[model samples]
Target: MKKHQATAFLLLLLAALVCFFAGREFLTMHEEEAVYPSPHLTIKKRLSDYFPGLKNSPGDSSVYIFEGQKMGGTLLILGGTHPNEPAGFITAVLLVENLEVTQGKVIIVPRANNSGFMHSDPQEGNPQRYSLSTPGGPRWFRYGSRLTNPIHQWPDSVLYVNPAGQKLSGTESRNLNRSYPGRKHGKLTEKIAYAIMQVIDNEKADLAVDLHEAAPEYPVINAIVFHENSAELAAVTLMTLQMEGVDIRLEASPPNLRGLSHREWGDFAKTRAVLLETANTSHGRLKGRPSATLIINGKDKNYMKAAQLGLLFVPFDEDGISLKQRVSRHLASLRALVSGLHELHPDLCIQLDNLPNPIEVQKVGIGPYLTPSK
Candidate 1:
């Protein structure tokens, strides 16, 4: 009888130890990563500044503004809408750290879904964070979930009706992308969405871009999704991107898609809404084991095999698309988009300086453009 008790106690102790260490590792994700914005940054604000209800809330994301000495139109860049898509988030960070607008104002939200970064997608086995080589040292960024952390807003409903009255699974309630022109007294995710809309209206934004990524198997993998209002701008940008050697397609925002940024941002606000997507093997279903290396290097044998079988929409060879390549596509499209905007709205020409060169970025990798963390 004594032996049995001893054995049980030992097992309990081992379980407790495992829980303790696992809990500690999980807690570290809550500590947000630091970002150093552009030297030309005019001011820094928070989502709460636009919506006081978001103050001190997890949804209160940081907003960076860079204004040129000369007056012109405004552009808003939203990143980290889906934290699992690192390319979008990293592109926003690069712009924040290296961009300089010389004619118009630019606003950036590097982490649009602040609560999303506090957690990773459950059961996908994604790493909590990944590292990139910088001139000074390694800089780390978190890989967050596609939805808001349940901790921030718990007890999800069985069905979710977004601000636009689109019915979605309750799980999508946490998806910031699905929450459009959010509700003032809605859930945490909704509040974040609402705050973003406020920025568009309050700042008189002329163009708004949301950065994102998709699996190679996805049909919309390497595409520019634009609202009806932005059709002309997207067409011009698509041609320019092709000229720059970037194979991209244009996907019009479906009118029935009620709550997405490209759809709702256009219907609700005067700003032209657009979203950019790049292929990421790390985010694909066929990806082998999820790890920091897979997220950074983006090489996956499974994807290559699938591509050979004609399963993927984008070409996936042994030289799997690296983070550098994905980011370069985004930058190229951005430059084209901005130029297109100038052509469409002559008065709203947003001349930018110090934007990363897409071709050069693809050649050297993402490290050089980023400022090393202290």
Candidate 2:
């Protein structure tokens, strides 16, 4: 072979090798993360059970049911609405693996936007996975994109109009949180939202909580945002959390916000809807580097400096807010909300037990509570 022809052939072979490995890494993200449900889990269903259109789709996710022998009210907890938020997703995993319901039912959707879990946001330099040292071994979870994977629904519009008649940036059309009370024939993200609404309506849920996390600089950090119908419950929850030294604030869901879970779930399904927010430094733009350590340990020199400048919404210092603390905050808030609901309506009281204490979780960390993978 001629020298130039041989060189060209070698270069093509090298490119092919690179593409092969890169493609494998990319496809690994599509594999669902392992979550060992607690022995108390009664049944596991798919999102398609509610909305059949979602069957065999990337958006289809697992729904875990923990039903008690005695009949009572039902509660729905949604996690991973934005897959980039690790604490939200981890907390749901914790509940599924540890919680025991004794007098009511608890339904948890750990990956509400399943499609979003299949990819990381472009240009963010975020880690694709982070691991925790569990007693069984190391448990890894994906750190994915905030929006639905474009591969599932492509070609963004210049401007997207929601079912509520509200206009948003075209990119937000793929945000699961912004597609609530979704259209049956809408986009992939919208169909997932619709399926959640179906769960609320068909199950006759008395309460629904959507778990989320925000950048530490966001003003709504460590907050409980509830629909108008849940104002009293939220206020009580805030007070209870404060009394327990949790320092959570309460925000009422704005009526004009069209597609949010708190607004749409309450308005359409008649279920008391609330959303919880925790502070996550890993997700903030001000963080120094994007690494698995940042997502798990959450220590960053830049964030500490920003805190000193009064630029952050939550307190930060040499000891950064670790994943344990963030997950503990979410757990504490959930406990308070459940207690408040029981107080407000005796008939709708949902009793639970065998939950890990928030303080203990913060102290010992999440690794111990997580069940070992078989």
Q: Tell me, by TM-score, which candidate is best.
A: 2
Query: Taking the tens digit of each residue's C-alpha lDDT, what string does model 2 give over 333-365?
Result: 889988999999888778788888999999999
What are the models' TM-scores?
A: 0.96, 0.97
Worst 10 residues of 1 by lDDT: 30-39
- Cα RMSD (Å) per model? 1.7, 1.2
Candidate 1 TM-score, C-alpha based: 0.96
lDDT of each: 0.93, 0.92
Compared with the true structure, what per-residue lDDT tens digits does model 1 show for residues 1-374? 69999999999999999999999998998988879988899999999999999999989989999999888889999999999999999999999999998899999999999999999888999999999999999999999998999999987999998999999999999999999989999999999999999999999999999999999999997999999999999999999888878899999999998899999899999689999999998899999999999988889999999999999999889989889999988889889999999888888988889999999999898999999997
- Candidate 2, residue 296: lDDT: 89
lDDT at residue 19 of model 2 (Cα atoms): 99
Regions of candidate 2 where Cα sits further than 4 Å from its true position: 1-8
Residue pairs in clash, model 1: none
